[model samples]
Target: MRRSVELEIITEALSKMGPHTPATRLWGRAPDATADMAAEGNVWAGDVHDVALHIVTRLYGRPGTPREASPLAQAEDAKRRRDMGDEIAALTGAHDQLTSAPWYPARPGDLVHVHYEQAGDLPPFGETYIVGHVGAGLMSLQLLAHTLPETVPGLDAEATAAMAGCFAAEAADCPVYEAWFEAGPRSLTIVRDGRPVHIGGAP
Candidate 1:
């Protein structure tokens, strides 16, 4: 009943089947072979086929033999491997795309604008920021100016509340907002009201 014993039985059964020419020898023929060689190849093929069928019948048709994992388990394992392969392929594709993309010129003191909905309000507002640093896939920006009014037609109490609420929500879920607040200017992309803004001759 042990797995080793079962394997040994299978091995012994196969060995008793007798050695004849392997299927590989059938293809090892010269261009100008005799009829005898062709007949020998056909005989080898038949022998190999019969041996293969016997092995299959012995493994599956007999009772009281250790069976491999169920078909469902095998299928699930195959699916997991396929899913992992897909994930790896997707990551590789993204990496290749990023590597092949055109470079954008960005640097310190470069002016850029960002826009997002003000908290508690539907209308979005824009803010201008000065780039503090730039690196691969990131740009740090310092707040240079905001739409908040310090003078005439400046942001009222309701507007200020809306802006704060908007930013607060964005800070929680938006990468751009998180970068602005937490990372202090590193971002994957820069946008103004959902539109991409090019800086420093970036196309």
Candidate 2:
């Protein structure tokens, strides 16, 4: 399927859940997964659900399944204040925030109808992933149900163009981003909300 169609399906499905994005994540400096906590790092994914689950299980203390856990319960007031367009005031007013939030499962093995990668299917560096989020500061994330045929590293052409447009569109228009990847290619970095904050690639 085309990337544009995929994004539309995602946006509609996520809307059914709530106003927020379906998932989020932070990537770790170390690429390998381990039992030790110190080794883990930031939230990263091709989709939101992957990152969201990472945040819930790692950052927050909910080590089990994230069926309906609300990571935002702590940031309610802060989120509300931000919604009012007073982020500075919100940070100083009421502050209870976390690195990420709780969301549906990210592992491809868990999803019912969504296509994804398995342990053996992943490539050497990593499996091409996707993460979808809503609002500011990546408040919500949802994993994509599909997988890319290859991986591209460093940056994505379309996504990069979109990021450049984001800086010009910010405030004037809400930002939206989409990236594609394939194996044997570097990552692509795109600035969606404001500037290119993460590495995005196409394979």
Candidate 3:
């Protein structure tokens, strides 16, 4: 029989009996079992139901069955979990706040990066796009380079110009629609996204 089931049965029997249950452990290899306390560990004690339960739990219970964690250990684990949650929330808020501002006052045909403030299966690095029409405090952006970005590492201008050249012989405007337009769920923060490439009158 499984140790857990046997223990349950033994416990049920002990429950029905008096507190001073005549509990004894015949500790040995089965057939030559003997009522002894010298084999290993405190297998049994005086006539008590608690002692019987402890003996059965130690001897017949599943090996390496983890006992419930102590209160202090549990508290520490909860604190660590709470701390981790706070850290993740802080990181997300920081990212959203950073992306909430436009790098510059963008104009039509300017190269830009469109940021994604929400989580999903998206490009980890921001996508490169070209700013399009602006009307009624809302600006549109066209998908320029998705697979191969127009910008280079360390914001290298010459290398990026070469890469952009490789993408196209000349720059041209593309149409934008609501389907392609990027915005949050609640309200449109068009000015916050679509940051322009030019800085100090240079690309």
> Which is the leading candidate under lDDT?
1
Tens digits of per-residue lDDT, candidate 3, 6-118, equal 35566566545644434342222334445654564434334344545565533322213433222233334546778654344333433343344344344566564433332
Total clashing residue pairs per candidate? 8, 59, 0
lDDT of 1 by residue, 3-66 (tens): 3333445445544554542231222344566557765544333333345444433332222334
Query: Per-residue lDDT for 102 in model 1?
Result: 47
- The window of 10 residues in a row where model 3 has the poorest summed lDDT is 179-188
Q: For all the candidates, what are their Cα RMSDs to the real structure?
A: 22.6, 21.9, 24.6
Put the candidates in TM-score order, highest first: 1, 3, 2
> Which sections of candidate 2 miss by over 4 Å?
1-58, 68-70, 77-203
TM-score of each: 0.26, 0.15, 0.22
For 1-203, candidate 2 gives per-residue lDDT tens digits of 21222234443454345345443422344456554546325333334444343333333222332221222332354366665433333222222221121221222122111122233534233222233333353422223223332433444656533322111111111111121111100122323333333332321
